[model samples]
Each structure stands twice: as structure tokens, then as C-alpha cells.
Target chain A: MVVRKYFKIYLRFLSRNIQSSMEYKVDFLLGILANLFQSILGLIFIWAIFNRIPTIKGWNFHEVAFVYGFAIIPSGISELFLNNVWLIPTVYVNQGNLDRILTKPLNPLFHIIADGFEPHGFGFIIFGASLCVYSTLKLGLSFSFLNILYFMVMITSGTIIYFSINLFMATLSFWLMDIVSSMVLVHHLSEFAKYPLIIYHKAVQIILTWVIPYAFTSFFPAIFLLKKGALMLSFLTPAVAISVFLIAYSFWNFGLKRYQSSGS
Target chain B: MVLKSKIKKYLALSKINIQRALTYRISFLTSLLAALIQLFVMFYIWKAAFSEKITLAGFTYSDMLTYLFVSQGINNIYGWYTTVERNIAYKIRTGDIALDLVKPLRFNFARFFEVLGISFVQVFFIIIIFTVFKILVPEFRTPKSDLYLFLFLVSTFLGFLCMFSLSFLVGLMSFWTLNYWGLYYVKKSIFDFFSGAIIPLQFLPLSIQKIAVILPFKSIVFIPTLIYLGKFTIHESIFQILFQALWATALWISAVLMFKLAIRKVVIHGG
Candidate 1:
């Protein structure tokens, strides 16, 4: 019953944001087109990297494309859903704007996260899906029902993990006073997950796997989907997603308790 | 004597802006950390690419590795200049540009100097950090020669002017389109592809090379990088720096004209 109520409220937010976006038709189209250009530029970067080489350490172009394509989908979903997290440090915590959110009956974090509905993220999702199809065709893999199920499950967990990371990072704004820098820091960190993990050093691989675990979002599951035999480890993504969100939730609560409102 | 005092006012504005930009010391540290991690990512990828091959295009494995870190460092000469977009966009949005324009100060010079102020702080930090990396890492390279270093500095300054002019023009677009998100990304995507920030234009395919010829973005990174790498002779380096100066002048003129036109069109919306 509670979930249904929240769902209705979120739908209202979706419609309102869409309405505002539609009010500026040119701006709306340009926004999606800009996202399309950025994602396409990313693909070009991969192509440039591969242009001078036959393989990257044993991985072919299509396999890397498959992984890169897989990585952006979850990122896009989280971007579409929780785009407001980007504003938290600069606006909410720093300027004492959280007071309004705190006064609301709904969960403040949920309100903040769900308030933003970016149609720009659709560019990434649509492009990434098509890239996946192209690569899958090149690899000659059958997209059977079980395989499709696994992709859906893993993609869903990956989105949750992306949201959890953004939530956990935004929660740091409550304590750190200004997390915009660290926010950008982690934004760049996500780019590292687009490629295979073995190419990186032991330290980076370790940090991506354990400390931040963004590798689980794209790299591990991608390798598993490619039948590269990290089968048991890739299965851990859903568990990792749940635990990470729980920890972030508790941490957010802890910070909320310490949230002494900033003043002018 | 009157002009001297006017110059003093702009310098004081720069001083104040520098102080304002430096208050986020925690931010400085985190941005530095971010730069280092990006360097690591580039290092590993290029390292992997070069594993089975000694060179890509004309770059040796070491040349490629060094180019990655150095180009990124030089590109970030405008690290804090990213704020210029946000500042100008906000000013135009809130109708603050009118107040700013009416001031005795020339508005464009003020905005340009504001870039100088923040980037002055940034240059120091970026230099120190890159220096630290050079000492710690064997692969981090120095300029090819003292002459090349001088030429690199000349080229980079001209490049900075060109970039700042383009940025101001992009920000001016807010007069017509109130939202800044799409504009910022569009500008960034252009620069990312054309500026040689991601990869050298020489390494890219011929089609991209043909496109890079028409875009001024390559002057901002590729020319300065090649100058520092001593890839060009003295005659060629001089020609490249002159080309950068030409672009810099052209872009500034365009920005000024656009700013004039855009200012008249600014109507505070929903008022």
C-alpha cells in the first residue's frame, strides 16, 4: 500500500518535469541530441584506442564494445532517476535547502532522488542497447530467454548499485560540508569501469573491486555474460547491490542525525 | 594616470576573485586526487594498447604514455575556468548581465580576467602536482628543450585566449536558451573530440583529421603538446603559434559581437 502511494507521487513528479521539458521544445531536443553526441564521442574514443592496435592485451574490439556498451546502461538509468544528487552538495547542504525536504512527510532522500527525471539519459540507454545488439551479433551469441533474463537481472542490480554509490556520496555532503570535488572524483572513477579490469594495475583493480566496487556494475557482469568464467563472482552482484544500499542507507541516517542546518 | 587607476581596479577585482576561488581548499585536494586517478586510467589503457605493439601512429609506447599525462595537465590549465560557464550562464539567466554591463568596467575584460584569477590559482597547483608526479614516476616527461618550453608557453597562452573566447560565446547562448545543461555538454563534446584532449589528432583516422583541420580546438591542445614534444622545427613551431594567435583574435572578435547582439535580446523571463 505504501509503495503504491509513493509510486503515484513519483508519477506526478515525472509528468511535471516532462511538461516543463516540453515547454522548451528546442531545448528538449538539443538536450537529448547533446547526450547522443557525448555518448557517440565516447564510442569514437574506444574506436580511436583500437585503431592502432589489433587487440588490447587479448581482448578484441567487439568484446570491449560489448563491455563499454553494458557499462553505460546502468549509469544512464541512475542518471535518469537520481540526477538531483548532483545538486546536493552545491545547493542543498551548503545552502541549507534541506530544511524543506526535512519538513516533508515523505523520505527526504527519496524525494530528492525522485524529483529529477532526465529524458537526456534516454540517449545513453538507447545507444547502449543498440551497441549491445551489434556486438552480440558480431560475437554470434544467441540471445535466448535465459540469457535475456540474466541481462535484465544484472542490469537492474547494476542500476541499484549506481544509485547506492550516488546516495552514499551525496550523504557525505552532510558531513564533509562540500563534496562537489569528491563528487567529481567519483564521476571520473566511473569512467574507469568502462574497460576490462585486467588492463589496470593491481591497486586500481582492487579499489574498483572492493573499495568502490564499480567494477561489479559493468566489468564483472560483462565478463560473466561473455562466458569468461567469473561465473560465481558475477552472481554476487545482486547481493553486493543490496548490501551496499543498506550500508549507504544506514550511513545516510547517521548523517541525517548530525545534520545541523547551515545558516546564512 | 586615469587609465592606470582603471587598470588597478581590474587587478583588484582579480585579487578578490582569487581569494574567493581559494576558499575551497578541501576541493583543491579532491580535484588533485581526481587528476591523479585519471592519469592512472590513461596510463593503464595506453600500457595495454602498447603491449603487443611498440608504437601507435608516430608515438612510441613511452611517447604515448608521456603525452597522455602532459596533455591532460596542460588541458587543465583551464580547470577552474569551467566556472566561467556557470557564472556567465547564471548572470545571463538572472538578468545580472545588465547590471554587470552598466558598470564602468568593460564586461568582457572582467570575465576574461576572472579566468586569469582562478586559473592563476590553478596553474600553481597543477604545476606543483605535475612536478611531484615527474619526480616520482620515471615516465613523466619534461619539455624536449628550453627553446621548446618557451614556445610551448607562448602557444599555450594563445590557446587559452581562443578557448576563453569560445567559452564566452557558448555562455552567451543562454540569452536565447535559458537552460545551460545541453549547451555545456555540446561545447564539451566538441572540445573532447577536436582539442586532442582524448587522443592526438595525428593518431586519429584521416576523416577525423580532416574535420580537425576546420576546428580551432586543436590549437588549444595538440599544437602546444607537439611544440613541447619538439615534434616541429623552429619554423613550424613559429607558424603554429601564429596560427593559434590568429584563431585567438578571430574567436575574441566573434565573442564580442555575439555578446553585443545577445545582450540586447536578454529579457528577464517570467518577470
Candidate 2:
């Protein structure tokens, strides 16, 4: 019942955000167009590279495209719902807006997430899903009902991983005072996952899998979906996602205890 | 005597900008780290690309590494904090641009000086990183001749002007648009692809290379990087540098004209 109430509040906040965003229709459209253009340009980059070389470390164009497309879906979901995690340092911690949020009846983190819904994220979803469908068709992959179910589960797990990582980084703002650079570093590191993990060195691959676990966000799950082996490891994504989310949530609470509201 | 005093005034403004940039030590470190991570990623990707073939589009492994390092370093030096477009858009949104217009100095020139001041600090950081990488990485190459080095410096300066003018014109679009974020990303995408920051223009298909040659974006990274790598003959380098200067002049004029027209239509709402 409590969760249902929170869901209602979240939906209300989302609708209000959407309404305000729609007030500037041109800006809204342009924002979505920009994201679509960016995703297309990324595909073009891959295409240009593949034009010269047949493959990069045995991963062909379509395979890389599948991974890249899959990667964006999770990132887009995070951008849509949890982008406020990025502003935690500057807007909430430094500006002491967290004090206001703390006074609310709802959970502060949930409020932050619900309040920051971005419509531009739909552009990412559209482009990513289109690319995924195109690549799957081109590759002639047949999906069963179970496969479709697994795909949905994998996407959810990937989104959870993205949110957990972002929240973990944003939680540092409580003590560090400014965590923009750290957050940017995390962003840069995650960009590597857009391509096939096999192209990178074993060390890089290991770091992405174990330390950062960005690999599970796109790579391992992509390989499994394509039936390229590593099935057992790919299935671990949900477990990893759940654990990471739990850890990140606990860390945020721990940081909240130390958060002495800044003087604005 | 008047010209000397004006130069001093701009220099003073630049000094203030430099001090302000120094305050963001954490940002500086993170930016450097970001560059290094990019270089590392490129290193591995290019390594895999070259595993089977010794050369792709006349770039040997070492040559490509050199190009990546030099181009990335130069880009870092030329990088601006919060693109001029977004800065202008924010100022316009907040009505701070009205105060800026009241100042005696030209707006673009003031911004140019501020960016130049930040560039000085960025160049310093680039030098430190370059030196450390040179010592550690055997593949990093220096220009073969003093003439190439001289041409590179000239081309890079012109490239900065070309990039600044383009950004300034984009910033002027704030007069028409309520939000500049979309425009900013679009502009950045064009630069990343056309400027050869992500990949050398030569590696691209012939049709795209032809298009890139006509655009000023190539002068920003492609031409400068090629000149730095001594990929062009002395005469060719000189011709490219002249081309860069030409584009810089043309873009600067266009930016000035756009700003003049745009400022007249500036509607500062909700001040």
C-alpha cells in the first residue's frame, strides 16, 4: 500500500514535469532530435571504421551495433528517471536543497528520482530500439517467447546497474562537497562499453566486468542474446544489479547521516 | 599609446580569467584524467585495428598513436569550459547578458580573451601530460623539423579562431531559441565528426573527406594534426595553414554579422 502510494506520487510528479516541458514545444522537439542525431552519428562512426576493416577483434559491424544499441537503452532509462543524481552535488548538497527535500513526507532519493524525469530520454529509447531491431533482423536471429522475456529482464537489470553506479558516485557529494569531476570520470569510463568488450585488453575487460561492472550493462547480456556463449556469466547480471543497487542505497543513507546541510 | 593601453586592459582581463581557472584545481585534474582515459581507450582500439594490418590510410601504428596523442592534447588546449553557446544562452536566460551589453568592450572579444586565458592554463597542463607520456610511451613522436613545428603552431592558432567563430555564431542563435542545449549537442556532433577529433578524416570515405575539406571544422583538428605529424610536404603545410587562416577570417566576419543582427532582436524576458 505504501509502495502504491509512492508510485502514485511519482506518476503525478512525472506528469507535471511533462506538462512544463511541453510548454516549450520547440525546445522539447529539438532536444529529442539532438539525441537522435547523436545516436545516428555514433552508428556512422562504427560504419566508417568497419568500412576500412572487416572486423575489430572478430566482432563484425552488426554485432557491435547490437551491443551499442543495447547499451543506450539502459543509459536512456537512467537519464529519463535518475538524471537528478548527477545534480545532487551542486543543487542539493551545496545549495542545501536537500534540507527542503528531507522535510517532505516521501523518501528523499525517490523524490529526487521522480522529480527529474527527462522527455529527451525517449530519443535514446527510440534510436536504440530501432537499431536493435534492425541488427537482429540483419543477423537473422530467431527469438522465442523465453528469449523475449529474458531480453526484458536483461534490460531492467542493465538499467538498475546504471542507476546504482550513478547513485554511488553521486553519494560521494555528501563528503567530497563537489563530485562533478568524479561523476564525469565515471561517464568517460562507461563510454568504453559501447563497443565490443573483446576489442579491449583483458585488463580493461576485467575492470569493466568486476570493478565497474559496466560490461554487464551491455556486453555480456548482448553476447548471451546473440547466443555467443558466456550464458552463465550473462545470467549473473540480475544478481549483480540487485546487489549493486542495495549497496548504493545503503551508501546513500549512510552519507545522508553525515550530511550537515550547507549554508546557502 | 592608446592601442598599448587597450592591449594592457585585455591582458588584465585575461589575468583575472587565469586566476579564476586556477581555483578549479579539481576540475583540471579530472579533465586531465579524462584525456588520459580517452588516450588509453584509443590506444587499445587502434591496437586491435592494426593487429592484422600494418597501415590503414597511410597511418602506421606509431604514426596513428602520435596523431591521437597530439590531436587530443591540442584539443584539450583549445577546449572551452561550458561552450560559448551554452554560456550565452544561460546569460540570456538569466538576463545577465543585458549587463554584458552595457560594457564598453566588444562581447566576442571579451569572451575570446577569457577563453585565451583559460587556454594558457590548459596548454600548461597539456605540456605536462605530453612530457610525462613522451617519457613513458615510446610511440609518442615529435615533429621531425622546426619548420613543421612552426607550421603546426600557426595552424593550431588559426584553428582556435575558426572554432571560436563557429561557437560564437551558435551562441548568437540563443536570440531565436528558448533553449540552446539541443543546438549545443548538434554543433558538438558536427565538430566531433567533421573536425576529425574522433577519427582522422583520411580514414573516412572519399565522399565524406571531400565534404570535410570544404568545412572549417577540418582546420580545427584534421589539418593541424596532419601538419604536426609531418604528413604533408612543407609547401602543402603552408597551403593548409593559409586555408585555415582564410576560414578563420571568413567565420569571424560571419560571427560578427550574426551577433550584430541577433543582439538587436534579443528579448530579455523575466528579468
Candidate 3:
């Protein structure tokens, strides 16, 4: 019942964002144009790389695009819906906005995550999804009922992993009192998920898998979607999702205990 | 005599700015870490090419690595001081620019020098750490030639000019737009792609490359890095430097005209 209530609040918050965005129609439309152009430019980089070479370590353009597209979909959606994830730690540490959020009836995390809503990101998400669909079809991969179910589960899991990683970084504000550059680090690491994990050396592959679990964000999803990898570990998607969600919540709770709120 | 006072004031402001930037040790260290990750990703991409027995267009492993390091270094130096720019623009839009306009010091030049000084502290630390890591890490190979060193410095300075002018233009948008964020966002997106920051420009298609070259973007990063890799002859390097200078002059003039016009607009509209 609490979850349902929060969902309704989120829906209302989203409508408010749309209303606010609508107030500046010309600027918003220009933003959409710039965003679409930027995303297409990103696509051109991938196209250029593939045009030069047949494959990078046995991962063809289609497979690589699959990874890029899927990773971008979650990233774009996250940016569009939860743009405050980009700025929460800064606000939490610098302005002690957390104090204001703490006094509110809504969950502080939900409030922070809903602080900014960027409709421009939805364009990128749609573009990435279409690319994903086209790439899957081009690879002659047949999507069955089970595969569709698995894909949906894994993508959600990927989103959770991304969120948890970012929250964990934000939690460091309790100690370091700043997380802007740390967020930049996370953004850069996500760029690596654009290509095949195998293209990297064994050490890097280990880092991605064991240290950051970036592989779960794209590599594992691509592996399953392509049906080239073991399905046994693939079914563990929900487990991974649950673990990451728990980790983020635990870390945030712990950090809250230690947070020395800036007296503003 | 008045010029001497202006120079003294600029120097004093720059010193304070640089000192404050140096105090942010964690931000500095993380920036270095980000640079290292970028270096490694480029290295891996090139390494994978070697493993696959594929040559990257015309670039060899050495060329690729050198390009990545130099471009990465240049990017750190040229990234916009968006907060500073926004603050300045905000003051202008609100008529508070009159206070600075009346100050004995040249407002824009003072602000430029202040940011340049802060960047000196950050860029110097970046260079030292990069040098130590390059000598220690095998993946980093030093670019060949004294010409590269000379051209790299030239390119970095000109790159800063191009970006500064572009940022100034974005700042001018505050006059008519009432909010400069749209302009800032657009500037960031264009610079990130065309300046060889996110992905190498060489990896972009021939048509895109042609478009990028004609813009101020190539002058921001790629030209300098490519020159450093011995990819250009002495004549070409000289020509590239001249090109950067010409573009910088053009942009600087544009910024001045825009600022003058924006002042009139702001005064009339009470923006």
C-alpha cells in the first residue's frame, strides 16, 4: 500500500515536470532538437568505428550496437526520470538540503531522485531502443516469450545496478563532502560498456566484473540476449537487482547516520 | 602607468584564485583518476585492434596512444569554467554588471586571467602526475619531436581562447534569452563531441571530420594532438597555429560585438 502511494506521488511529480517544461515551449523544443542531434552524433562515432573494421575481437557492429543501445536506454531513462541523481549529493553536502528533505513526508531518496525531470532524454531512449530492436533483428536473433521476459528483467536489473553504484558514490559525501568529480568517474566508466567486455584485457575484464559489475549493465545482458552465454547465471538477474537495491539502501542509511549536515 | 596598476591587480586576483583551486585535493585526485580511465579505455581499444590484426584507419598503436594522452590533457585544460561564466552572465542580466563595468580593472580580462590562473594550478598538477605515470606505465609512449611540445602548448592556449569566446557568446545569450542555460547546454554538447573529448575525432566519419575541421572544434584539441604525433610537417604545424590565431581573432571580435549589443538589450528590457 505504501509502495502504491509513493507511485502515485511519483506520477503527480512527473505531471508537474511536464507542466513546468511546457511553460517554455520554444526553449524546450530547441532542447529536444539539440538532444536528438547530439545523440545522432554519438551514433555516428560507433558507425565510423565499424566502417573501418569488420569486428573488434569477434564482436561485430550489430552486437556492439546492441550493447551500446541497451546501455544508453537505461542511462537516458535514468537521466530523464531521475536527473536529481546527478546533483543530490552536491545538494546534500553543500546546502544541507537533506535536512529539508528529512522533514518531508516523502522518502528523501525519492524526493532527491525526482528533483529534476528531463523530457529531452526520452528522445534518446526511444532512439536507442529502436536501434536495439533493429540490431537484434539484423543479427537474425529470434525473440521468444522467455527471451523477452529475460530481457526485461535484465534491463531493470541493469538500471538498479547503475542506481546503486551512483548512490554508493553519493554516500561518500558523508566523508569527502563532495561527489561531483566522483559522478564524472561513474559517467566515464559507463562509456566502456559501449563495446564488448572481451575487447578489454583480462585485468580490465576482471575490474569490470568483480570491482564495478559494469559487465552486468551491458555485457551480461548482451550475452543473454545474444544467447551466446550460459543461461544458468542469466536467471540470477532478479537476485542481482535485489542485492544492489539493498546495498544502496543500506549505504544511504549508514551514511545518513554519519552525515554532518552543513548548517546553512 | 595605469597599465601597470591593472597588471598588478590581475596578478593579485590570479594568485588568490590559484591558491583556492589547490586546496581542493580530492577533486584534483579524482580528475587525475578520470584521466587515467580515459587513457586505459583508449589503450584497450587500440590493443584490441592489434590483437585482431586490424589497423585503425591510418593510425598505428603509438599514434593512437599519443593522440589519447595529448587530447585528454588538452581537454582538461580547456573545459569551461561554467560556474564562473554563469555567475558573470547572471550579474550582467540583473544590471549588477554596472558595478564591475565601473571598476578600474577590465572586467572580462580580470575574469579571464583569474580562471587562467586557477587552471594553471590544476593543469600543472595534471602534467606532473601524467608525466610520472607515463614513465612508469608502459601503455604511455611519449610523442616524438620538440615540434610537438611547441605546437601542443600553442594549441592548448588557442583551444582555451576558442572555448572562452564560445562561452562568452553563451553568456551573451542571457540578455535576450533571460536564462542562459539552453545556450550553455548546447555549447557543452557540441564541444564534447567535436573536440575529441568523449571519442577520438579520427574515429568519426570522413564527412563529420570535414565538418569538425572547419569549425573551431578541431582547433580546440585534435589539431594540437595530431601535430604533436609528428602527423604534420613543420609547414603544416605553422599553418595550423595560424589557423587557430585567425579563428581566435574572429571569435574574440564576435564576443565583443555581442557583449555590446547584449548590454543595450539588457538595459532596455531591465534584464
| DockQ of prediction 3 | 0.46
Order the candidates by DockQ, highest first — what do you get? 1, 2, 3
Quick one: best DockQ, which candidate? Answer: 1
The residue ranges of model 3 lying beyond 4 angstroms of the native Cα positions read A26-41, A85-96, A103-108, A111-116, A172-176, A254-264, B28-32, B80-96, B137-143, B176-182, B196-204
The TM-score ranking, best first, is 2, 1, 3
- Give the best candidate by lDDT: 2
Best by TM-score: 2
Worst 10 residues of 3 chain B by lDDT: B78-87
The list of candidate 1 runs beyond 4 A from truth reads: A87-105, A257-264, B1-3, B28-32, B267-271
What lDDT tens digits, residue by residue, belong to model 1 across residues A181-204? 777788779888988999988988
Query: lDDT of each prediction vs. the true structure?
Result: 0.83, 0.86, 0.74
Model 3 lDDT, residue B65, Cα: 68
DockQ of each: 0.64, 0.64, 0.46
Candidate 1 CAPRI level: medium
Q: Could you give candidate 3's per-residue lDDT for residues B167-207 as a string of tens digits? A: 77776666555445655566667887888765677777678
Mind listing the fnat for each candidate?
Answer: 0.75, 0.68, 0.46
Clashing residue pairs found in predicted model 3: B93-B271
